[model samples]
Target: MVSLQIVKQSNAGIASLPHGLVVLFIGATSGIGQSALQSFARHAPSPRIYTVARPSTFASHESLLASLRQSNPTATYKLVEADVSLVSEVDKAVNRIIEEETKIDILFMSAGFMALEGRKDTSEGLDPSMSTRYYSRLRAVQLLLPLLNKAPSPRIVSVLAGGLEGPLNEQDLDLRDPNNWSSWNSSVQATTMATLMLEKIARENPRLSIVHWYPGPVDTPGLAKIQKFGMSFPNPMSQEEAGERAVFFTTSDRYAVQEGLLPVPAGLEVAKKSGGGIFLLNPQGESTDNEAVLDEMRRRGVDEVVWNFSQKVFTACNVQARESKDEL
Candidate 1:
């Protein structure tokens, strides 16, 4: 386990890196994403940060950004309004960023939730929970790839169940069938599919460092909601702790494919990558191997299957979005 002390120590070096680093944050309105945003703003040297928030949360997130501005006067923060549970909305958000920025150095995504109340499909015909966790997140990455590739060392940190990927329900990738669509099953499918799709992207963009992190249990509003469901974990990591570690993962070369971020901490070697060439990280910042399941999926061409399915969904979303605009 990479100790919290080491994590903080590495994050402290963020100010030393070149100024005006461009970062995009999806789902930074609350929870782990919010915490990580605050940490990055506090430590980084004049970073130009863009964060996405829904209309309902925009005012509150503006308040958060206001406080961050006071704390880090040099950093620039822009909040784009969009409901990230919809892929079409994600497209709008990404387009807004693309219009202004030439390159993105870091793309930090932690926008997701557990569908404890069961599936609620959006107008786009996808469960909002799964859409937030998987589809929209993937869409943002897909749209931002060109900008990411332009950076000298680009990194993407997705906070989800990285090492705990399980067998996918190949027959029903989206768990559209009610009988197969338990909350747990949806979570598993989202987690597993995210890992597969991200690995494919990592391989195609070798210069990009992608880290899929499972933060175990962190004390946040999300966890509080889970507690009300009569489910809980003991001694969950503090939000501040998780945020610091997340910043470490974002900036430290310990998890980087190329050396552009902070140098790897002493006594720590670069973390190992999965067969598909992305970091599957556990809570403690250690690399995890889930090859038993992942290898078989790759061998069976499941990665390609996922990629093709996702592309179709994205295309459909784009068509629908354009049609809506025309009607408007």
Candidate 2:
């Protein structure tokens, strides 16, 4: 386990990074995303930070940004209002960024929730939980790839289950069948599919450093809401601790494909890359091997299957969104 002390010590060097690093964050309205945003604002030197929030949360989020501005007067924070559970809104959010920025150095995504009440489908006919966790996140990545590639050292940090990938329900990739759909099944499906798709993207974009992290049992409002359903952890990491670790993941060269970000932490060598050339990290900040399952999936060509299905979903969502606009 990479101790928290080492994590902080490594992150202390964020002060040394060049100014004007552009970063875009989704799902920072609350929970881990919010904490990570705060850490980035506090540490990185004069970073141009963009964070998204839904209409209802925009006012309060702006207030939070105001506080961040007071602490880091050199940083620029832009708030984009969008309900990220829908791919259409994600597209708009990305387009707005593309219009202003030439390149994006970091893309940080942690937008998702556990639907303890069961599946709630968005107007685009996708379960909001899966859409938020998988589809919308991937949509943002797909749209932002061009800008990401333009950066000297691009990094994408996705906070979700990284090492705990499980067997995919190949027969029903989206869990559309009522018989196969459950809260647990959807969460598993989202995490597994996300890892596979991200690995495929890594192969295609060798310069990009992608880290999938599993932050075990964080103390946040999201957790408080779900705890009534019998979910409990004996010792959950504090939000501030997780935020600091997240900053390390975001900026440390230890997690990068090539040495570009801040130097690898003093006593740490670069992390071992997965077969797909991405980082699958455990809660302790150590690299994990899930090749027993991932290798089998890749051999079966499930990655291609996932890519095709995702394209179809995006097409359908685009059509629906356009139709809604026409009606308006």
Stretches of candidate 2 exceeding 4 Å from the true structure:
none
| Per-model RMSD to reference | 0.9, 0.9
Across 207-238, the per-residue lDDT of candidate 1 in tens digits comes to 99999999999998988988899997999999
User: Which candidate has the highest lDDT of all?
Assistant: 1
Mind giving the per-residue lDDT tens digits that candidate 2 earns over 1-328?
A: 8899998888888888878999999978888889889878887788999999999999999999999999999999999999998999999999999999999999999989888998879999999999999999999999999999999999999998998889999899889999999988999999999999899999999999999999999998878878989888878899889888888999999999888888986778899887778899998889999999899998888999999999999999999999999999
Residue 92 of model 1: what lDDT? Answer: 88
In model 2, which range of ten residues has the least summed lDDT?
A: 259-268
